[model samples]
Target: MSEAVLPMSATPVATSRAPTDWNGEAMRRRIALRYAAERRFRLLGLCAVLISAGFLAFLLISMGANGARGFMSTQIKLPVDFPRSPIMIDPAMLSTNPDQVLANANLPQVIESSAQAAFGKDGDDYISSGAVAALRKAIIADPGILTRKVTITVPASAGIDLAAKSDGSEADEAAVVKLEQARALSTGFNGGFLTSSDGTDPTVVGIWGALKGSLLTMAITLALSFPIGVFAALYLEEYAPRNRWTDIIEVSINNLAAVPSIIFGLLGLAIFLNMMHLPRSAPLVGGMTLALMTMPVIVIAGRNAIKAVPPSIRDAALGIGASPIQVVFHHVLPLALPGILTGTIIGMARALGETAPLLMIGMRAFVASPPGGITDPATVLPVQIFLWSDEVGKGFIEKTSAAIIVLLIFLLTMNSIAIYLRNKFEKKW
Candidate 1:
């Protein structure tokens, strides 16, 4: 149909709308936003790390500052007459009636006399009462110590010690200065704090008892926790079937790791104390309770470490005619040891610092003597720190800080050992 054909050039139909041009500005804006978001996230992470580090440093510094005073003791030099008639006796008499002679000996009078000669009016308040007891014990141990004209350095009272260290009140400052002018007051490293047992006197109180308890408790805890946890992990990871029960157990273990430590303490109270009738305030009970608390962490860590082992190791061992147990034990376990030990170290360190559980078991009791065995009554370092912190005396303030420092040192040592072991055992492959 020869209808009026429009000229091809004249019939200009609207072309399809042009595809949208790349919005360079929008692209730039989106990229810049992404980079900004990344930067903000990084800054937040760094700030968090820095804040944590700052708090830790502050805590350590504070503890160290106060603890330094505890390391030194104020002493007063006294010239004393050790009367040989009462104090210096035959060695045979010591073997036969030592207690009687010590009971009858006038050690207190000697100390009091010497102190009076030195401080004049304030003699009783100037020297530690515990120093008299210490002197009595020494003389009892060797009566010959009384034969000579003894010029001994005796521990000054806590107030005097504090004044000498510049932490005492204004009145104490005068006493300290007077003693200094008379050349009777001096500061020396306190060897007794490392050697002596816990005492009523802050000047004589030492962490040795608590340190021993911690060592014994950790030994028991490690003995119980490590093998049981490793075996449980081994079964769950290498042999246990994937099923509902296993899943429940896995979930329970993970949840247990997050449970409050005090709850475990209560559980220990119920089971170890109420049900079993075990001895209270013994390292045995403390260690058992801590083992319960630490096992979940070990299990979780162990499973993770075992899973990290290559499946090829298992397959290759099996292909070589090795049994499943042999494959896991020979090939997988050795590779996982480093991680397992790291987890163990972390658990032990946590156990060492735990006060609530130990307190629940009566470990907060005043243990005057170091524990000789796991079954003996004991108090750990954390408990000692807690007890000291609750004390009202100014002397205990420094003592509490000193105990905290000791705890930190032990923790650092444990972590260092963990690092060393991890590096020693870790394989490149």
Candidate 2:
């Protein structure tokens, strides 16, 4: 009875509402704000990319402008009356024992005399110190040339080279002018920069030795780190039980990845050089040292890649009578390979550019010749660049920049190869 007597204000009432106004001012404002935020974010990203690109362009342009000359040689042609010159070597001796013949012939004196005869008393000063070696090489190449009058084109001295390319001292400028007037001074591609090895004279110094050493060292590093890192990742992710020991190992690996690169250098120095007695500046030791530093990064990347593989994939493989090992190797590994290669590229690139670790391991030595093998004394490109940058000679400055260009090219080549491999292995499913 009391419920029936309830007032209208006390009674429950049903209400109806209009459809949502998607085009309403509030909704439009919210949508506009989102679009504006997205636009702002895109603008920020574009600006970031442009700034990075600008820096990279500046680096390339500056290096090219400075180091282009490094890849060029200034040559001065000089007439040598070999028959009248004081070269005492028998033409026959050049073929049988050229080194001995050239050494005994006193090529420096021969070159100096030839230069002075062609130009004047200061002609010798305009010739590169490397002229002796150049002349010796020419003699060995053609023993008959030793018996006749010939014009030899040899590299100009460093000062004259600078004067021809950019700037030089007053004497060098005068020499350049005179040589130019004689049509003896000409700038040409420096094939020797790629073919020869390190030396005191910048005209003859080359990057081949350091480049070869870097390749050999990287070979060792890739050989050691890739397989080891992959297997380690597999074990840690798939097989290792959840235990205190596994946790500790996981933490240690993470920490190792963050350790200062110099720490790895010290470790290599102590173990490879002091205790194990490996060759101090050998690519073998350097490669092994770099392997230690690169492995952790590879392992971390590999683990994440492996973990990303769908569990259903493993279950399906197991359901089809595939063993666990087969599932991991045949299926999981293939799926993870692309990611693994990405990590490998990053690791290798970092190793390639590293100087502190190599320096600690004695790779800073002045390697005058390319190493015959990994165990032989060698220096990597970064160490070579570091050494060249420290030189007082103006020629070495361009050389340093040239070395940097080479290093960048090498890195790009390596990364390109790795990326190609990764793309080849990547799967859609």
Candidate 3:
């Protein structure tokens, strides 16, 4: 009991430490540094987006500027006294075969005479060669014009057209000024650009032929590729046994997707052209070639889309006594359709813009008319643009830009339709 007398002096105590200052300079600096890093990252990302947008804007603006002129054409008005002119044609013949009758009517001579009477002897030089066709169309539309004096407006020559629209040589500028002073020269929408077909004259060339060819080619490509690609994907993903052969096929497909597009062109040339004896420069051949190139892409996309369908869905279907085929076709396929369509859009878009494959198959030929069928000789928009771009004429520059604009519109329209279909089929699990 006496030992407890020294215990109070020997007692140990716990120490108290100061709390961390979250708002202090060091701590605040660290938080600020993290926020600053995030802000820098965001700024860099925004800058990248802006730069990309700027480049796109520049391209679009430049194209629009150059292409807008292509949609317009310059015209010169001339008064023709057809009754007094030495034009030989029976107006009655127009109702049966107007083009032939007009062709034989020596309308070019009448136009030359009218131009000389209206402006000068050199006035014929300012008129486009397309004027004869224009006059023929007008005469056929109004046979009464042949019996009376009337003024007819016709497209000007390429040089005169350039002067009226943008820049030109001194002689062309002078011609333009003279025509303007007479109130004879004017600019109007180029209706021919949409209605006519390719020709030696740029003013008369139209995109309809190439556009139709592209449509036909793409139709064939889609018809051949989509079903086959989907089936291949379904077999590989759902039915194929896990073996070396399947693995080799999968690897081959992946490699094919990465192969150069020109290689596909060569393959098409060798097989479709040399072996199959398919029509050269036909949409059918072009489409078949593009289909070969596009199938692997569709298959890869389809397999991934099918794989993303949950295993539980399959389990549930099986639990309900649903057959394997029924479960895949009714449930899995519907669920995977949106993603598959997305892949189709990508593949089709690539095919639409491709030239080498079609070119190799001889679709680079100068198609004068729209294809009546897939087997008809034709050229797609890309090949047409390529051909136009290679021309030495200044008029083709505008035509090339215009064709590009048309191609872009076509691509956008096609993608929009595909996206719409995808969204329509999209379902949440």
Give Cα-based local distance difference scores for all models: 0.85, 0.91, 0.91
What digit string (tens of lDDT, one per residue) describes model 1 on residues 202-307?
A: 9989999999899889888989999989999999999999999999999999999899888899999999999999999999999999999999989999999999
Candidate numbers, best lDDT first, in rank order = 2, 3, 1
**lDDT of model number 3:** 0.91
RMSD for each of the candidates: 6.1, 4.0, 6.0
lDDT score for candidate 1 against the true structure: 0.85
124-219 per-residue lDDT for model 2 (tens digits)? 989998888778778877788887999888999999999988889998898898889999987889998987778899988999999999999999
TM-score of each: 0.89, 0.92, 0.92
Segments of candidate 1 deviating more than 4 angstroms: 1-23, 84-100, 133-148, 427-429
RMSD of 1: 6.1
lDDT of 3 at 331: 86
Positional deviation of residue 180's Cα in model 3 after best superposition, in angstroms: 0.4
- Cα displacement (angstroms), candidate 3, residue 131, comes to 1.2
